[model samples]
Target: MSMMVNSPLYPDDVDILAGALYAWCAERSIKLQSQEGLFAANVAISLYDAGYHTQDQLLGALHNYEFH
Candidate 1:
């Protein structure tokens, strides 16, 4: 398993991060439950706290998610 720091969903700013995560969840057709949204929000906050600062940085973390 990869660490969260290595996860591609990490975001630079809170809004964009949330947008990316929201879109990801939406693509999966995940229902926007309060609990789930809260969890995603927390993850975004943690990523921000960890010093991620660009879309490329976040995308690099997401490398594992890419389809070959």
Candidate 2:
């Protein structure tokens, strides 16, 4: 038997996203539920959807993004 899901990301892709989000928040002391944290999450997801699927690629893009 097999199961099908309708999502573009895989488990490892989620892991990289979580790890990058954690590292970014930890470095800046940003709460996971805070506004900036939400922004970071959005940016991460956007970058991932834009083909920044690798850990290094996502992290680098996240770091490069300014929080204005």
Candidate 3:
């Protein structure tokens, strides 16, 4: 399932990453509301593009990620 997200830079495969992020967050009980989902999707896409291709990597990134 593809999640609808609004972001500035969406790559061709962003939806795939976003869906993975949605599932990842869901598994962790993270609440990514409608508005916040856009940012979460963006972060997910960035991580995916950066070569962190697994949920565990994303989970670790989320733990160490600092919002600027």
Candidate 4:
């Protein structure tokens, strides 16, 4: 499942977040419908909400996240 774009984010932000989510999941071979995938989505959104706006920032934070 894709992350739901929140009202505060612009289209570019959405693109960055989505791409980050995709890369994060892809690296771990995680299905978006699974528990881990859900966690990843949540984490990505949370990070974005917290100010990791760029793809590199988001992905770096995500990669460092201990998702399991």
Best by the TM-score measure: 2
TM-score of each: 0.47, 0.81, 0.51, 0.80
Query: How badly does each model clash, as a count of residue pairs?
Result: 2, 0, 0, 0
Give one digit per residue, the lDDT tens place, for model 3 in 1-68. Answer: 13433344455455556657777567657677745555666677677657766666765675566654
The TM-score of candidate 3 is: 0.51
Top lDDT hit:
4
Model 1 bad stretches (over 4 Å): 1-12, 59-68
Clashing pairs in 1: 8-61, 8-62
Question: What lDDT is reached at residue 17 by model 3?
Answer: 65
The predicted structure with the larger lDDT, 1 or 2, is 2
lDDT of 1 by residue, 1-68 (tens): 22254445433365666656666557556564766655554554455446655545543333334322
Q: Pick out the ten consecutive residues of candidate 1 with the lowest summed lDDT.
A: 59-68
TM-score (C-alpha) between model 2 and the true structure: 0.81
TM-score of 4: 0.80
Which of 1 and 4 is the better model by lDDT?
4
Query: Best to worst by lDDT, what's the order?
Result: 4, 2, 3, 1
- List residue ranges in candidate 4 displaced over 4 A: 1-7
- Model 3's alpha-carbon lDDT is 0.61
The per-model lDDT (C-alpha) reads 0.51, 0.82, 0.61, 0.84
